[model samples]
Target chain A: MFKTTIFTLAIMAPLVSACGASYAPPTQRLADAQSAERSAAELGANSVPNAQLSMKLAQEQIAQAQKAMKDGDNLRADSLLIRAKADAELAIAQAREKGAKIEGEKAVDDSAAQKATNVGQGATK
Target chain B: MNTLRNLGLLCAFTTAAGLVGCAANIPPQDLVTARSNYERASKGPAQELDPADVHAAREQLDVAEAAFAKDGDTQATRDQAYVAARKAEFAEVRARTLQANQTKDRVVAGMHADERKAVALTSAELAQTKGQLATQGVVLQAQAATLATEKQRREEAEKRAAQAAADLAKFATVKQETRGMVITLSGSVLFASAKWDLLPAAQMKLNEVAAALTKEDPTSKMVVEGHTDSQGAASYNQDLSQHRAQVVRDYLVTRGIASDRITAQGFGPTRSIADNASPEGRANNRRVEIVVTPAATP
Candidate 1:
């Protein structure tokens, strides 16, 4: 029983060492998070309240992920980067929705104004 | 037996941990929330006001639904649902904002149009007013011209009347009669007794009279009448008066008076101005009378 326990412990130790050796920096996740944040900002996320808040959260998470990467905590950094990317994507969606809505409203208003001007000109004529 | 038992327990623990780590169950709550949010957005203002946002949201929701269906209870499914939910909420916010902006834009545009119309109306009104003023100016100019012509006519008439009065005072004893201005000259001063010859001094007086008559009205007609006393035979007196009147008319004609404008007549012992029984009265009765009629247009 003692030999079997020692053998099990030896097997687990090698597996744990192998897992620790597999640590890689979250470069791809960080890039994805930064790309998502840039897209959100381009979509005017910072102009809306809810979307701005989400963008801020994503920014903080990405900062945290950078810190974790600096600290050699690749797993923690990867997780934080994923979360940041998701938040940034959500922010982008929110911003795009708001922008589209504003554009639609502007179109309707422009049409109405044009009609009104045409009628007024006709009346004058 | 104890070592084997320990190994089995360890194996069971490892298996349980592995199962826990790989438990990719669908995030039912998140999926439901995402689906609800998407449905609400699709039916609400997002559908029309923000079609692009709505389309994005729908696409995210579909991805989430697919993820969940393909890998239920997985991190990928949860992530997809989270993103979908966020997109749905974003779509609703965007729709509301867009609608509000549309209304605001419409109001602003309407105001601008009204302002533009007002400006155009003002310009037109101003142009009309200017045109009216221009017409009034033309009318005023015409009236001014008419007034000027009337003033000139009045001035000309006044000048002519003053000149006629001056001529009457300087040269002849003028009297207004029904015929026109009558100038009386003593027959004794114009001719030698019963003779048809004018005295040299009488010629100067006649020249002055002729000048005054011509200046007064160049186109006037003159009648020369010879008067005589009642002392002689009517035939002899008539012959003498006619010859004397003809001499006076001929002398005026020589002094630039048109012969066509002078007519001579003799009245002997007729139309006397005074009683012929008195010498002084006879003297006044034997006078030459010149009557001048003014021209047709003064």
Candidate 2:
């Protein structure tokens, strides 16, 4: 039984090492997620309500990914980074949408003011 | 040794069953969600406005679906499906952002168009108003010119009247009476001793008098009275005075004084100024008086 146990250990050791070597550390993916998060922050995503929620989620996922990477769970870290990038992108999109909407509203308001001024000038005349 | 072999064979068999079970059963929750998300995104505005982004999302979804088909319920499958779902959502969001930008552009274009139209209209109105104002200005200028011309004419007429009065004062003894202005001329200066005709110097003086009298108000009446000294017989002096007054009146009329406005009268010695006993008094009494009655007096 002891010899069989030693043979079983010898047989599993290479398999475990192969499993560990199969996953590369998600360094590039981590960098990608960090870069996306930075872009979202630079876009003032935290100031917008809809983008703020997505940014918060992205931040938490990035933290979780870092922890996963430290724990040597490359696949889990990569998975978390994927979610982080998506959330960050969503935040950026939301911020952009909000900016576009504001611009549209401001344009409409300016047009209305200009029309009103024209009408007032005509009336005085 | 047989126990270890049997354990390895059982593990192999369990993995095979698990793979087969995963294929026959439903997809993972994340993959299912990603499939739904892609379906919604495809139908959304992303399809038209951000087709490239939508195509990218579809490619990512295909990768996730391929992973799910190959890996069964593995963590890689779930992670890829999560990424795919987020990509689909991102496509939708990007499309919405693009739509918003398009809306802003349309609104801005419309605003510029309105501004241009308003400027054009305002320019037209300004031109019309300028034309009207210019016309009114011309009329006002014409009226001002007419008023200036009329004022200058009145001032010149007043100056001429003042000059005529000054010239008349040179040779005439003029005085104001209750009836009118009285202009007196010596009888010896007008006629010789008993002659009824005027002297050459008298005629020249009478010309000035006639001009001055003509400058008087057109509606005024004038009377020329001939007086004689008391040394002569009343009837003879009266006849001579009458003839002399008539001659003076006729001379004044010929000099451009109105004949209709002038009449002659003879008051021979019946009226005298001084005691008539002295020579100077008799000379003063023998004079012709031209009386002008203004239009206002009866």
Candidate 3:
């Protein structure tokens, strides 16, 4: 009977190793997603419609990733976290672009006002 | 023996998997991009122009660095880097806007200061011009007063000269001589023949002559000369002529003329005006002449 138990253990070892090799926790990915979402919000993502939408989607993916982690599905959690991070990056890019455009417009307006002041001063002289 | 060999193989496989899972991941390209962006923004106006945005970017970069340092978290590091890059970009844009506004404000303030200075200078110049005009007015008033005083003095002098000329014409034959004005009085009309006393009519005529002399300039000296005809004895005529000149001087002194200004002289038959052989010539030679000398001005 001992010989038979040893023979069974040898056969199950490869299966256990294979199963253990596939086990990768999504802790880093979830943390990354959360960090990206926070950064996007801090970058004024909520001020733009498209950026706000992207940020909202990122938040939902992060929530789903957390749920998957709790259900003991590390692969699914990692995949969801990757999608969340991508959405957050898109939101950040969109917000920055919008801020840049606004800044450009403000600069143009300031330059025009300065030109007007110069012309007024010349006329006064 | 077969069981022991299988357990060793399982131990080796598990150790290899644990090593792979625990190893630190290499920094991703996104993380590098985020770092580069953060550095560029820090070196730019982000640090001073928009400190709040720079601080937020710094926080994300810190998280990314920490996650990268902790093993087995490549995704977290990459995501953190991506977020940090965007935050850096935002900080740069915000800083640029803030810096531009500050520059524009400074320029406007400088222009205002220059305008204020120009106004102050104009006010100062206007005040100076007003002062100059006031000074010119004062000078013009002083010049006008001086001219008025000079005109009044000239009119007074002309009036005095006219009065003097009219008074001299009244009682004497006046002439402009080298000594000054000469007035001649006939001796026959002034005194009786061969007598030294002046006639009553001669005294009246002498009074008018004294009045005219007094009306002349006060700073003039007079010489009174008495002349007689050649028919009289020299000694007797000299005494009579001296007495006659003394009487004329005495009359002038009583009429308010100073005695020191008159000199009495007797030229008895010595210097005759005409040929003393004829009666009319002798009559002309017997005359009294008054010579006026102007006093020297200082």
Candidate 4:
């Protein structure tokens, strides 16, 4: 009787272990992606209107490209994405020249930064 | 030794037979009673109890009773007396459990009655508070309406001030103490394709904007925005939009817009005036944009 019970438990152990291991990667990836996306989005959102506008455009392009791929237009999607990327780079450069910061805590151009600060202060326009 | 072993075997056999007789008499009735109790308990305020207890007790008792019944015993025998003892013990347990359950029910009932009265009193108080709050709200709303009127008046004044500033912007050959003007340009003026090159007409228009920006102030700033339709990858759009914006920036530079104060940016299809479904919409979706706002005092 003891031997039979031991045999059953041993068989069950591997199954339980396998079930526990399945959720690791996706959970970690989701957390990392969420944190990174939020900071980047915040920085982009409060940039100078022009730079913010530019970033918004680039983001839209990226979305369209992703949509294209979803619709099975891989080549067109790639082309669209590439263009969007270029646009973002140029936008970033211009924003920086206009005294917009690109990479730091709350990194966005000056006018945009002010807009963000104003929003926090309840300035709506 | 044989007598001793036989005596042990007889004890075991008699015990087993006694168990059988007890189960045959008690189990079915007990099952009905226990199930009724559990179902009633489930329906009662005690419904929050873990059902596992009832389930485990019922299952264990039923199985043990069944196993004993299969062993068998006669009603009018010593074995029967032993069976009675066992059954009595289980019945005592059931009675005790029921008594405890009754006491618990009584206590809970009293608690619920008190709670209901408390809740009713609280509700009455809340209603009174709400009535007072409603009156206050009416007064506040009237004040808010007046304040809204005042806010609209203030906004109108600000609008006029901003407009005057804009008009002054049109005439200025130079502006000082302004860090830069944040200009969000419309997508309608800049691109013909995925390419970011400026059209001839667009260049002319840009030159006009730059000329205004060149102001006599000699310290003006300019930022050009490039926008695109949502039609491609994010990275690609960002880069392409940026390139197109830069192209406009280069054009502004050639047109004598100050390199230091001038900046261009590309926003790939992030902002859209029209949907991306039709040709007209797409055309509207693609373009250079600018936003003109007073720069910082620097």
Two-way lDDT contest, 1 vs 3, winner: 1
Worst 10 residues of 4 chain B by lDDT: B73-82
The TM-score of the first chain in every model comes to 0.78, 0.84, 0.83, 0.43
In candidate 4 the C-alpha lDDT for residue A48 amounts to: 59
How would the candidate models be sorted by lDDT, starting from the highest? 2, 1, 3, 4
Per-residue lDDT over B1-298 for candidate 4, one digit per residue giving the tens place of the 0 to 100 score: 9999999999999999998667566644434444455445445433333344334434544544454466422222222232222233233333333445555555555555545655676677789999999999999999999999999997977776565446544522223323444444445555566666677767666666665555524554456776777788867888888998788888878888668877877777777878899888877666665444455567
Computed on alpha carbons, the lDDT of every model, listed in order, comes to: 0.81, 0.87, 0.79, 0.56
| Maximum-DockQ candidate | 2
Q: For each candidate, C-alpha RMSD in Å?
A: 11.8, 7.2, 14.3, 46.0
Candidate 3 collision pairs? none
Worst 10 residues of 3 chain B by lDDT: B163-172
Predicted candidate 3 versus true structure: per-residue lDDT over B104-152, tens digit per residue: 5666566666567656766777899999999999999999999999898
The digit string of per-residue lDDT tens for model 2 on B1-298 reads 9999999999999999998896646688988988998999999999998888789889988998898777677778888888888888889989888888888898889878877887888889889999999999999999999999999997877777667666667766788999799998899888899998789999888988887887788899999998999886899999988888899999999999889999999989888977798999998998998999988655
Go through the candidates in order and give each one's DockQ. 0.11, 0.56, 0.04, 0.00
For candidate 3, the per-residue lDDT at B96 reads 64
Candidate numbers, best DockQ first, in rank order: 2, 1, 3, 4
- CAPRI tier of model 2: medium
Identify the runs in model 2 with alpha carbons over 4 angstroms from their true place.
Answer: A1-16, A19-21, A123-125, B1-25, B72-74, B112-148, B175-298
To one decimal place, how large is model 2's interface RMSD in Å? 2.3
| Candidate 3 lDDT over residue span A9-125, tens digit each | 999999998798565788888888899899999999998997898899899989988888788777767867876886787688667767766665665566567557655755224
